[model samples]
Target: MAVQPVWHFNRSALAAIALSTLQSGLAQAITLMAPRQMGKSEFLQYDLLPHAEEHGWRVRYFGCATVSPRALTRRLQEALSDFAAGEKWLMRQFARLAGQHAATARAAFPERLVQELAQLRNEKKPSLLVIDDVDRVLQLAGGDTLLREILRAFAGTNGQARLVLSSTLTGHHQGLPALLQQQTTVLTLPDIGDAFVHHLVGQYHQLTRTKREDDNPFGKLSPYQGITWGQVDEGIMQDAFNRLQRIPYYFRALVEDLVLNPERAPAEALQVQLARLQRHRVAVLSWEEMSRLDRLLLTEVAKGTRQFYGDTLRQYLAAQTGAARVSTSQVQSSLKKLMRNRVLGQEADGRYLIIDPHLAAALSVTDKA
Candidate 1:
């Protein structure tokens, strides 16, 4: 089959809501919070940004995920300086030179940023500045300083520069609310709803309708070898969505797998996807950071062990750690660290569970029946 066009779920409604919130004068800043790979950045770039631009707002986007603390100001200056020149050709040339000067861009960053913001403020059109992955900078050494500088610059714009920030989760830094220093509104990027799944079902049919019999991916011995793309339908796609925990990234992966091997059952394809996630760099790094006791606790939780202090688990912990005896105190200490690290999360009923879905699945492989 030929390569399929990238499918997109237009979040124009949500964009309208966010922009309306900003224009209502209730909040000068809005923060979008959602888990990673939940389309936070897509909404900002594809939906929200274009919607604001269409309404005659001047916009700039700065992503913090790839930049260090030192590069923060320089990067923002580049984004701000995009609007510095009067002519389109002049703007393009300035942007090119800005890219070339990134390494030595520090010395003149502040002054340039001030000039850019002043220019933006002087413009009659409203400004929208999106800072993606804003929470990450808070974890860096000089992040607080950078945030304060940003706050000072935009806050001084007298509401001319409307700010929209995106992060995996909110309140990464305790001073975040004060740092923005405005009536900041927090919004969650909603899940890719059922409509998108239906759209994918249609897209899959379009992409696979012309597949030749000789190009089938299934082996003669495979149970689904005789199954065809025509057998995949909206119900199958919806089931696949739920099976993948309603995450868009994984759902897209499933569709891609189907485009190559249309006969694969959603569950079987999902297992392959989950297995890949088990070996993902993030999952590997997280696993490497765990202590033996931490690893043991993780496995126990994955197995639905709620009673952390129970005698049976204490014995298991003692056996695993080669300790004379294990106490409730030790278990509690490790659990606290795991929770703080976000390796584990507590539900409303006080049950501790793994936060990352794939990590949970990988560790659960050793669970007893």
Candidate 2:
């Protein structure tokens, strides 16, 4: 069987470089922030992790969406214990000092796990903990504090370990901005461009042999016969560039949609699919998915109150909901939910804004009426 091709992007190269250049004693973390479905996780998993392992680093990857912080901490403890056991001298030393089994050492709490990993350092080799979809992790109760503790532990470890946090640019997680500001190096993924689109489209055509041919009745070539970039129509490629907005995931979706429905005209099919997506977005979650207070909070956000101080938002929600007053905690809970849903995003200046333009536009139309 032939080896499958992996789509390489400029951002993937940059991420690998960033990981390779991390100084051990710097007490720094790297943040890869991008929009959802933009391949941040895939880049970290398929590209960055392999690169780190090849350079002799022990990598522990946690998908934060599926794993809670407490569970992740326990896993880290076990990994550290196993790492220590692999080194006979260190295991013996630990055994002599504690007079306990390795499993007992593995039972350390999250805080102590960090300390242990931090202290287990070799100049030639280091450990890496990659937390993907960190925004979801922050959604869990006490997640921000847990993450801060983990990062702090690594920072104090004298170059023993490093952390890579992958998250979307949207959402407001308490203390995350401060944690990022303190010592993390931030990397943003740029939009995909025409050159990448051309390469990708050409690759798809060649792989699927979808070019028009005179010999076949349907005017499609055999799968074994590859197509060149020039053979693909420039107009269709341009339409793809415009329609997909240089997002690789969107492009792939469009291509898959076209492949699955070969009888439909490519451009028409793409437009139809995009329209369906817009309709789904409009219908999926509106007033039904949110509480009255949540809708009021979002309405206020949509009305151009770019920043919502806790008290201000609480007051607005209370007034809109016809309650005498609202508590700050209630307002905060609603805001976090909105942020998590990607309906609202926090700016660098700590102001909240609606990040999804389509949803914002739909809401604005409804408000105007």
Candidate 3:
């Protein structure tokens, strides 16, 4: 199989390795969390799923953000039914039964899936189910209950079926039932580091030195046209590492900008592109996605009111909203949510700081408005 080209391997590869190693352990579920645009989805699609399939594990991927619970359940049942039947004749037989007893299929799909999974185990086969954007699933009505039941059905598979849940580090995960949470091993993707940056720059340089052909892996661009590897000095690479903050998305953008503006030096081109990206990220990327209360709390932190007790925030909120009073519990709850989302970091002294400085600048603008 032809594998897709990936930019550079990061810590997410380590997380995938850990998941593979722990397959025989007590933990049956792994929860992976990363910030937006951090390549979590691509890592699972191009790397993890292929690895699992190579080891003879049947893989079912659920894009949780795009499907409802009913639709998800139906799709899962169809896939498992296909797996259980194997032959075309057997699949036709299962399809006939599904059409004849639609109501029964609705009620018994979970049980049937469990049975089929057991059959796979008997045949010395195992399965893996990956649900991406699991946080979106938890936000739906009765989603927690539905997820709990689905996981419960898989419990009897005795390690035949492994579950991997991927999502941004949103507060919605707090809604997961205790049983599910306890069984899950949480893996967080750290921010891009210097090593990956160095590796990526090296990869680009190698691609440039290779003969430019129609089948050039790095794309059709002539090496002579733009800021080739030769033009990017050590100082320029270090400047990119610092200015792009080593984030993959930002790094890619900077590289593209340099390619487009080859006349400019790498460091100068990167500075221009980085400023543009930072502005877009602060105004359009991060701030627009935050909740109202989260935005407010972050704005307060950006304004130098770092330490916020429950009562302190409640009073501040009351004054800002023109409400007669606000509850301390509400303030505390928002703080916890913001912390989970990684928008705010709490120190040992209980003071909170806006985790991203660019976001702080955006919040300050909003505060003044």
Highest TM-score: which candidate? 1
Better of 1 and 3 by lDDT: 1
lDDT of 2 by residue, 1-369 (tens): 112245554345665676766754433688887765667777787777777776788776777666555686545444444443334436646674676665655454456655566556644678777878776656667767766766777677666677788776542233246666565777776665676666666656654553444336765555434423343355686676565544566667676655554555566756775665454443335546778987777767667775555676677667778999888677788889877775667777777766644455456766888
Relative to the true structure, how large is the alpha-carbon lDDT of every model? 0.71, 0.63, 0.64
* Tens-digit lDDT string for candidate 1 (250-317): 78888889878766776788788766554551432367677889889988888888899999889989
How are the candidates ranked when ordered by TM-score, highest leading? 1, 3, 2
Model 3 misplaced regions, further than 4 Å: 6-16, 66-100, 171-180, 210-229, 264-296, 299-369
Candidate 2 segments whose C-alpha is farther than 4 A from its true place: 1-12, 23-27, 68-111, 171-176, 210-235, 276-342, 345-351, 355-369
Model 2 residue 366 lDDT? Answer: 68
After best superposition, candidate 2 residue 152: deviation in angstroms? 1.6
Kindly indicate the candidate among 1 and 2 with the higher lDDT.
Answer: 1
Which RMSD values do the candidates have, in order? Answer: 6.6, 7.4, 7.1
